[model samples]
Target: MNEEVENAFLPMTSVSSGKGSLVIHDVYCYTNQIVNICFINIPNNKWVLIDAGMPKSAEKIIQGAEKQFGKGSWPEAIILTHGHFDHIGSVEALAELWNIPVYAHQLEFPYLTGEQDYPPGDPSVDGGLVSEMSPLFPNHSIDITEKLNPLPADGTVPLLSDWKWIHTPGHTPGHISLFREKDQTLIAGDAFVTVDQESLYKVMTQKKEINGPPAYFTMDWDEAKVSVQTLRDLQPELAITGHGVPMSGNELTRELNKLAENFDTLARPDSKT
Candidate 1:
């Protein structure tokens, strides 16, 4: 009953966006300066919303879903990759709006149920504006107890027949990535990203490059490295990440492999140990 919602909304500028197929479409929220929210199309008119976007984005997400699926449409459930503020900023609002169940890994429950806060972002890790502003980003946990549910222990995602949730930690204790084995399509949360999150200019431009999680928020570099390798081992042909554009084929393979091999040099921050 006591859910914390952000009062101030980040100013945004609209930008271009696209989809992989009818099965998956993402709306770029906060104009393209923030995170992406995905809508996974189920067999019937039903669909699933993956990771709510920034503060005050529930309307944008709802409108985008209506435009893609149809007017007066609502998803069956909401699946979260993690409880990062950006990912779940509007979750409490949207969950109440639609009165749907929200699922997340059990390890993430503390953050979602208002029991704990995430570790502070390390501004000393990098010198860019985003890094400089890291200290201001919300690190408090939200209380969405009534609507929250733990993911199935067997790793099967409800409502999504073909996709499975893979435990991919490091960025957060309970981070998970969604994968469709048939097409090897991966919905990589912050387990790994396709952009240099340390740079504001690249994030604003929405660059396409394989990299590790956002440096400032990642608490376990070793786990992050292992998590990247775990995903690389999956050999996902196509990957839609928490940031940047989607990538696939041999190019994605090549860059991902390189990132996995040279993670310390390319993705790890200077102060993390």
Candidate 2:
């Protein structure tokens, strides 16, 4: 008799890879691989999905949603923070699977419709293997024209009455963050993540910190700095960033303030000695 076996290494998942938590009673945050996706509940069994995870993660996201909202659960729509590969990775799949519309800032329409592609990432700007590996990530546009819709100019998030979408560009021309004025809870996209995303070790360990957008992918340092300042002005009591675990209260305040005050040192790659 003869037997054969296969050998392989575990997945690239982080410590919090498959974990989730409730930032509030109705707002749920789940990590899909390295990126975080939000499920915001609305009354009458309705909910919205904010940003999709890494590519080919549609199945995982759907399963998580089913487990979150129970069987047969589907979001009213998908809200894109930007057209970057990581955030919208599973978007096309999820939208097609559920036949739902996808909303994005008009500036992002070109990228989503395959009209334009983002510039290749700048690996020379940051420290980490992830940064060095940036050249491999796709900077090309994705086609999702039929399912795409422009976000409202008034800032109101469709289907979410109390929440507003704030334009937070720099990570991308149309990057945006969602905010709930009442609780001061913010769903900040890559405008600023809660982890040093360009650092492979930090990303893998899920280390928490208030860092600017991934250095390799950020196109405009000046714009990114202003975006962070704008968010800091909001004084959010809680923030669910695109990456890393959710941060709230004083920890969030202190970290955000420090990040804003020292962005040149803390975030700007060119400032490093």
Top candidate on TM-score is 2
Error of 1 at 123 (Å): 0.5
- Where does candidate 1 clash, by residue pair? none
Question: For model 1, how does the per-residue alpha-carbon lDDT over 1-273 read when each residue is reduced to its tens digit?
Answer: 223338532322223333323433432222223676788777876888889877666777787877777888998999999998888888989999999999999999999988999986678987977787777777779998999999999999999989999999999999999998988999899999887777877877777899899998897889999999999999999888888777889998999999999999988877774
Cα error of candidate 2 at position 41, Å: 0.3
lDDT of 2 by residue, 1-273 (tens): 001001111125688876788879989998998889999999899999999887777888988888889988999999999988778878888899899999999999988888888887677886577877877777778888999999999999999999999999888999999999999999999888999888888889988888988888898888888999999999999999998888899999999999989988988897333
C-alpha lDDT of residue 251 in model 1: 91
Q: How close is candidate 2 to the true structure, as a TM-score?
A: 0.94
Question: Candidate 1: lDDT over CA atoms?
Answer: 0.82
Candidate-wise lDDT, in order: 0.82, 0.86
